[model samples]
Target: MQRILEALGWRQGSFVKPETVAKLIGDIDSTFTISANNLLVVASQSCDVASSQEEYIELSIVRPLSAEAFNKQYSHNRHPRILHIEANSNSSDEKVILELKAHEKIQIKKSLLEEFKPDSSINFLEGNLNQYIDWLAGRYKRPALPTKFDQLIASSDKKGKRKKIAKRANEYLTGIYVDIYPNRDIKDEETYSVNLLGIASNDQSIASATDALNEYADILKDAGMDVSVPKVGTEFKISVGTLRQYQRINFDYLSYEENNPIPPDTGI
Candidate 1:
């Protein structure tokens, strides 16, 4: 649960502000619980509540930002042992949780919620969980860069005294390729290979790809994956003929198999 919570950006002892505001924005549920040892109250609500719900159960609410002043003012006399866990979509188990003393104020600012937007993308994936994950692991297994790179460079200041220099960079996307690998011993090294690759494209597309790729990269790394950037000059290359033949297809029941087999047909 902590791992999943960290994935949502909630660590121990951090106060959640406005309290209910976070849930309203993030689509998360709030509950109350009390500590078994000290009987400390944990409340994840708009303000605070009594121990009538449970003395030993603790509650926590995680959101984009905190509204401490708002909660304190409206809480009346029912403030519990409020602790805000300062984590959002950016947290993985690898990122250690910062310890907080009891009753410490959890800081909230506009920028923090913007930082957690990637988890919103994860939520988007959850909305189409079965379809998207299967498509990624199967039909979309071969990664490619978008064609919008040249626009970013051309629009940038190529002349003048060069206040800023525009340069090309390679964006690498690493994930569990999850396709069948060649292994004679089926029982030992079974189906699927996890491969990492670096893709080069026009500047604009790389920018968006970089953000999306890094989010997944963190998740993969946390899952004990040996992720690496694909070779740029060798493994990947762009040709005029290749671009003419390139087409991004929809991966669905008619396109890919359950196991992501080539030429379709193989189902898991």
Candidate 2:
């Protein structure tokens, strides 16, 4: 005989349908009402969910990707507001896009979850679990950039080249590192220097990656930023009055794959 909780799918990435919510937790309270039409995925650390440490398990709500977001390659991915999980990864039939919003997370009683049928619940890919957890945690962990600096990076959208560049770059690049000049909190009045260090996802992508990166440099130059992108594994100095910033700017639109674990930079 299986242990009560052992038979339950309480691990991170395990998700159940809205109809299952009423069966598991019941309609005695409004949780089911709050969770209508949403796919529920365990959001807490898997170890924490397995332990008898808490009364409730954190779960995030999954919803259909909007038409606009679905069409945009990068908007639905690696974004702070939501995460895009492909349908195939979730056992859905269509090759559609699904969005999981961070703010919409809910906590359900662990006791109720333990009673649900294990086989009925669907799960996201084991490989995607880490990224999902990081994305969830990143909701709070997002870097706080100087308002102007952030706006400056976001300004690339005005050039209308970012989408083309991002689509190309995310397709061919694997990992990224960045260095910022005058390494302190940047002010709005001054121009800053940026260096991008990038890796090609594979041998086949090196040529494509080179092309995309060159265009990326042009995008930065057009923005009045002095930028450099070094070859993979090349070393650079982080001198005085300089700091390395991640999750701030450069290739933020790039999504991840199992082949590459290191995340790329934010939008440039």
Candidate 2 lDDT, tens digit per residue, 115-219? 565324245554566667766766554443344444555576575675556555765664444556654456667776877655566777777766766776677
Question: Cα RMSD (Å) per model?
Answer: 20.5, 8.2
| TM-scores for every predicted model | 0.20, 0.66
lDDT of candidate 2 at residue 105, scale 0 to 100:
75
RMSD of 1: 20.5
Assess each prediction's global lDDT (C-alpha) against the native.
0.28, 0.57
TM accuracy, model 1: 0.20
Worst 10 residues of 2 by lDDT: 233-242
lDDT of 1 by residue, 163-206 (tens): 11111121322111222122122332332233333333443455
Task: State the local distance difference test value for candidate 1.
Answer: 0.28
